[model samples]
Target: NVEATKTVVDLISEQMEKGFEIPSDKVITVESSGSSDNVAIINCCFGHRVNETMGRVVALLLSARKGRNIGIEIDPYRIKLTPASSKEVLEVIKSLRPEAVPELAERALLDTKLLQWKIIHSARKFGYLSKDLDLSRINLRKLVIKLKDTPIYREAVREIFVEKMDVEKASELISQFGKSIKIKVYDSLSPIGLASREHAFDLLMPGKPVEALLRIFRQRLEKEVTVFHCLNCKYTVKTPIRLIGDLRCPRCHSGLIACFNARRKLEEIPKKELHRIANLVLSHGKKAVLAMNTHGVGAENAARILSKYYENDDKFYLELMEAERRYIRTRGFWD
Candidate 1:
């Protein structure tokens, strides 16, 4: 086992050195198993430290660029309360972020069959039995909690939940329901009412209810999230910007006018025409009308604005010519 573990670790390290891009589908799946029919005894057989050491070694093995395909197999008992293994699992669990623990546990429990069995056996070791005395029937969200600071309970829960539930979803649910679990301080005359509140607190937090609600909400939201597309480029942008202005397109400078406030689709117009109109508007300033008594742009302002976007338009070119002639005539001295 030591040689095998070392070999796996070396392979992973070598692959990682080459810029960690393992073909997950092509890599070998490795695991640990024992010769025993009593799965619980088999799982519990490994000491906690040994399990911790193995988990660390296996984790290193999987760290190779192509090592994601490397799988760890332990019998149903080894992953639980056994001294070496349980401590190791807890160490790993502690290393993970709090938000990540629940979902990671759920995934391990649900997706990996042997891992799930190990979790169940560990739960039995900790006395977290269902009403029916079956681990399978127990509320997973409840079972996978800190039965207040004991490593045995902590490891058992973290591994189970992360293996079975979606971490993000679980986190959202836990936040939403956490307040309900708090005991309310009511000034009730009846001692029985206060006793009931204490009883409720002792019964446990609303973790399972939160999980159920999250599952329902997830199902409802799955169908409602739709992709929005950009009309001009025919690209599917997850959330497209709505056309608010009679603005020019940033990409092609096409006129973009919104058809309706409720929709993102817009109408496009030619860039040349838009520039021509803008130039014409800017040219018809205040001072030009008083001087020429003609519907033409002011000499000074038109020259400043029109020189940039319209170098070749007939109307703008004519305006520029007129401005030059006016300048020459107004100058008392000739050049």
Candidate 2:
């Protein structure tokens, strides 16, 4: 399998160099017998770094075309672009300036965790740091500064270049555009392309939410439990929104039910705060309680959302969904 992968890479390289013509009925196919050798040919012939290289390329193309994020998968044989044809990729590549690639490729890795890990690993591998050193105690910024422009730093970049990416070949390919190579857009995927589309390690680009995802989101909200406290009787109970009925205290028959997150403890909530929450529930009723139960929607946000004039329950739920999405996206920044 290893030898076969090497041969494929060699053949591809030779074809690229010699300008081999393809027959109308024939398509060049690359295959590997084992998992370990699956991308060996691709790494050798194309840019070595599949994920990083393809990610950068796809991101650049998407920006140029003002396109939405789409899934991109690349293997030894072909690049699988979901909702995008091969022709689109070629056109984008053609537009890129060869002189700009090295800078762009390096910039793509600047904020990535991969680059950080590689720098530290290369430092250790080059004997710049003791093998016994504890990584947790070391400050990453200080370490990066200490190792910058050294042989260890160079080694890390070189590893990314040789093992992961071939910036040189990529630039060369860009320069040779329209000279030895031509773009051929296909209306449908070839058999080899179909085979390559089966496996996707990760989503190179994130896509927008669809109806199915929104349904799952709603299901999660419905299943989540809300802590309800009775203002008149001091009775507290946890109830899932799906099982909630009447919004009244079971023991006291009171409508003054305050909702809190299920994770909150009754003993921890101050009496004055509980009364304020009960007032909010008294004013807004069951709808506000459901909003409070939603993931990442606290009492203040729930109250603010309820203050808005929504035409129906659907509109209210849509606003809550948007709020939850915003919280989910920005939670990492808060941490």
Candidate 3:
């Protein structure tokens, strides 16, 4: 196991030394399951330290480049986040700025929706009107919030729907108002709420490798949750953006969701390159596993071997549905 881990680590280090591009391998797939499963571990944190899972993703990138098949497995239970109650987080809304809340969520590896609800609370504090959990129905009336009885913004009361705004555009608009009143506008846009979430893996479940791997799982598995509209009925529902999935509105059950992938949300920020580096670290660990893999699976099959274990995406759910049908045994309740 130690020798196997060392070989993959050397391969990864060579790639890292090559500056993100692993030395091109002529082999399309190298299938070898001779090594022990325990060889799947590695010592890497990067210049800044990375979790074991994060290292697997880094190894995956290398796997793709090297054509060296590796078995990457993931455990769904390791990455679960405890949901906080709405009221509990509402108390912290005032102390945190609209932009800073997502940072809090990101640091904790919490869902972006967690920050979404908090933004709504802060918006309400600034006297903006909202009627949705996601704050998709927010409206800012000019006179709703005033400092010393002065209108927050002399501009006509309007809806700066966050779905239609970007971070820079939102920031520019918010700056029209004074610093004291900036957050009100910021609240409306929910810039961080609408943007993509980038997980901070190393900090979560410190010293645990799977926690690190889950971070990479998040990046690869994360989907853009978008609002879809039914043009025929004028009804909308939020759903995932998928190339091979249906987007039907639950309300009408008659029309397909027309807005999948149509607009970028308020909180969608691009993953930093450092995060990619973190993923490389994750991939390396997986490579280590492959170096010692005893599974006897074919080469091409080795890629995404972890998919069955990591739960996310419609594919996993579909598999679950199939399992339930095949194994449930009874048709009715209380069998």
Best by TM-score: 2
Mark the 10 consecutive residues where model 1 has the least summed lDDT: 33-42
Worst 10 residues of 2 by lDDT: 36-45
lDDT of 2 by residue, 64-89 (tens): 47456434444333443444444455
- The deviation in Å at residue 217 for candidate 1 is 46
Candidate 3 residues lying further than 4 Å off, grouped into runs, are 1-149, 154-199, 210-226, 238-245, 248-335
Candidate 3 accuracy as TM-score: 0.18
Q: How far is 38's C-alpha from truth in model 1 (Å)?
A: 40
- Per-residue C-alpha lDDT of model 1 across residues 260-335, encoded as one tens digit per residue: 1112111221233223333443354221211121122232344354445545434443454444334332221111
Pairs in clash, predicted candidate 2: 48-164, 49-164, 49-165
Question: Which should have the higher lDDT, number 1 or number 2?
Answer: 2
Ranking, lDDT, top scorer first: 2, 1, 3
Question: What TM-score number comes out for model 2?
Answer: 0.39
After superposition on all C-alphas, the RMSD of every candidate to the true structure, in Å, is 32.0, 15.9, 23.1
* Per-residue C-alpha lDDT of model 3 across residues 72-125, encoded as one tens digit per residue: 321211110012222221222233343432223222211223233334444454
Ranking of all predicted structures according to TM-score, beginning with the best and ending with the worst: 2, 3, 1
